[model samples]
Target: MTYHRTRIRRRRAAALLAVLGAVAALIGHRSPPPIPSPTTLARQLTVAAGDHFHREPGSGALGTAGGALPDDASVFDDNYPGITRLDPDLLSALRRAATDAGAIRFVVNSGWRSPAYEDELRRQAVAKYGSEQEAARWVATGTTSAHVSGDAVDVGPTAADSWLAQHGAAYGLCQIYANEPWHYELRDGAATQGCPQMYADPTHDPRMQK
Candidate 1:
């Protein structure tokens, strides 16, 4: 009976290990993603500058938008979550990128989620995740918005993100948020210090938006 119980315990241990291994592969918890070379991404984004640095580091898999990117009239290219008109040079850069890639049309995963939309998303996250702190860590909203400036963006991949980090200087696009890997900004190296400096004014925040 003792030997039988020991065998059962070993079987259970083996089962647990198998389950953990499967979970690791599903989430890619072991290794880092294969980021593209700086040259490859520069070709992809249609920009080439020597001094570049990405503020955001990762990509969101179809966060708010559906599956792959779509060239829908409702979703304008290079717009914010609100579909606000983007900076002219910014638009030209993105448009040129799509025309060159010949693979994926530049589509907005989200142009802008309005203040109301942001509040709702926050509420939903708090309800599901059990705390505002947890929710905010995952989704940003309102007063702490990057969408208001019409300068921020969340690209599709780290490879692309890495490319932007390496060569986005000439185009004026910079990753914006600190914790959110998908968020970025086109600061253009204004007299501002960073997003924190730019958003210090309530006027720049979405919750403060009219």
Candidate 2:
């Protein structure tokens, strides 16, 4: 009788081992989440930048009337002739971050600007602030402005800026100036290790010294 009981116990232990092994094998074969490749990101960027506006579901085509945007335009504001004026990579990054935050739109306060426009902005800053040095802290010259190169964007609606500040680095986008939470630029490897320390302001950036 004791021998029969031992045999039954061994069979039960063997069955348990088999079940555990199968479970482990199943887990090992499970696929990981897909990471976006650079090529894929580039393609997404192109598509996003090419579109002029994002309309709500059921909304009809939009047209500018009396120099005013439709009430439901995707972006809060834009100075460019078209959204494509912004850097594709930057737009791609912003889109990814916005999606993660459940934001409906990026709300661009500014995007690519012509050299003449940048220069004019600088001049206005100097006039209002009372010195070229003070203006330099707030606005870059035409030659040095990232906006003129289509590499930077100024996002608005304080909530969007706050979201970017906390999460932009995960998409290779980073706030460049400590004083300007709305400003962001693409920085290589920002997605993994994260962005570098921000300058206190543009004046503190070495790139602005020139």
Candidate 3:
């Protein structure tokens, strides 16, 4: 009777071991997740890089001064002080122009600068050019800067600039300086009379004389 009981227990143990071994074999044969192709991996990396580089509206990258912008930014995103602080007329014109732009998108690089931001840029420009005189061609004094007055916008991407050059006069947005093709300002009556001739650079503008 003891030997029979022992034999029964051994059989049960063997059955349990066989079931566990079968489960292990099934798990080992299961398929793994597919690896992404090189192209897919590269595209994912590019998107991640773009997200890392870009700041959302009102992210406070430069404290409250807030002039930096991303490529996909809209003129209507007023969460940014740079967009809200723009001259009303200029902002209105930009909105209208944006609506009619079709495929072309305006990417604001800089707008509505604080005095501190303007001064810092001026200092950097002076250092880059090795003289205040040469720097004046690029950066303006805070007191006389159109950016400080909320009257100017710097837009970018070569395609956007070209599109603006062609259609901007109708919206009163004219490139202010030949040297700075990205810079634009609203010119009153530009729609009817056409835009005024662009200055060679900011140095040629009478406004900078002050």
Candidate 4:
């Protein structure tokens, strides 16, 4: 009887070892997490206040007539016109979107604005809207303006804005204000997680409260 009991115990131990080995093999063969899509990877690119700004090479003259912009021209991307300086990351994302969409041209209605220019825009807004509080809804103050920070761009015409509205998030660009289809900013994780809910306007943006 003792011999019989030892044989049974050995058989049980061998079965247990086999089960453990099977489990280890199963784990080793498990698939890796899915790779992010190309659009998703593009969206992960960084946009920071300190990011460098770039202009098209040899852009020399500044006015609407259009040529290579002079180094002193207030804006970059003169090739398309009306664009001021743009954050490097933002520009890259915009170009990528344009390429993906097969857009012939992407016009920048507004980009990096100096504090003074923002202030002037604010003044115009106040004049048109009748109150600073009301103007704040559409135009941010110089200090709070995303344009001043080089993190925002106002793209146009209607077709471009429409394309961006639908596809910008894939490139990490999001329309920040519900009212401004032309405006977009870089939002973290927008590629994978998607963009945050938009405020109605600058006035409604919590960042503008400061």
Model 1 agreement with the true structure over 105-209: per-residue lDDT tens digits = 344443444444445455655665578665554445654655434444455445555555544544555554444444556655532433233342223346533
Using lDDT as the measure, name the better of candidate 1 and candidate 4. 4
Off by over 4 Å in 4: 1-84
C-alpha TM-score for every candidate: 0.45, 0.62, 0.69, 0.62
Where is model 2 poorest over a 10-residue stretch in terms of lDDT? 59-68
Every candidate's lDDT = 0.45, 0.65, 0.75, 0.65
Q: For model 1, where is the 10-residue window of minimal lDDT?
A: 46-55
RMSD of each: 13.6, 17.5, 15.2, 18.6
Residue 198 miss distance in model 2 (angstroms): 0.7
lDDT for model 2 comes to 0.65
Q: What is the lDDT of residue 129 in candidate 3?
A: 60
The alpha-carbon lDDT assigned to residue 113 of candidate 4 equals 65
Off by over 4 Å in 2: 1-79
Please report the candidate that would top lDDT against the real structure: 3
Please list all clashing residue pairs in model 1, or write none if there are none: 80-111, 80-112, 81-111, 81-112, 82-112, 176-184
What's the CA error at residue 95 for candidate 2, in Å? Answer: 1.8
Cand. 3 TM to true fold = 0.69
The RMSD (Cα, Å) of candidate 1 is: 13.6
Q: For candidate 4, lDDT tens digit of each residue in 1-210?
A: 999999999999999999999999998897989986422321221111111112333322322222112222322354533243567788788878877877345666567666655675667667755788876777787799888787997665668878888888999999998867778998879999999999877878878988
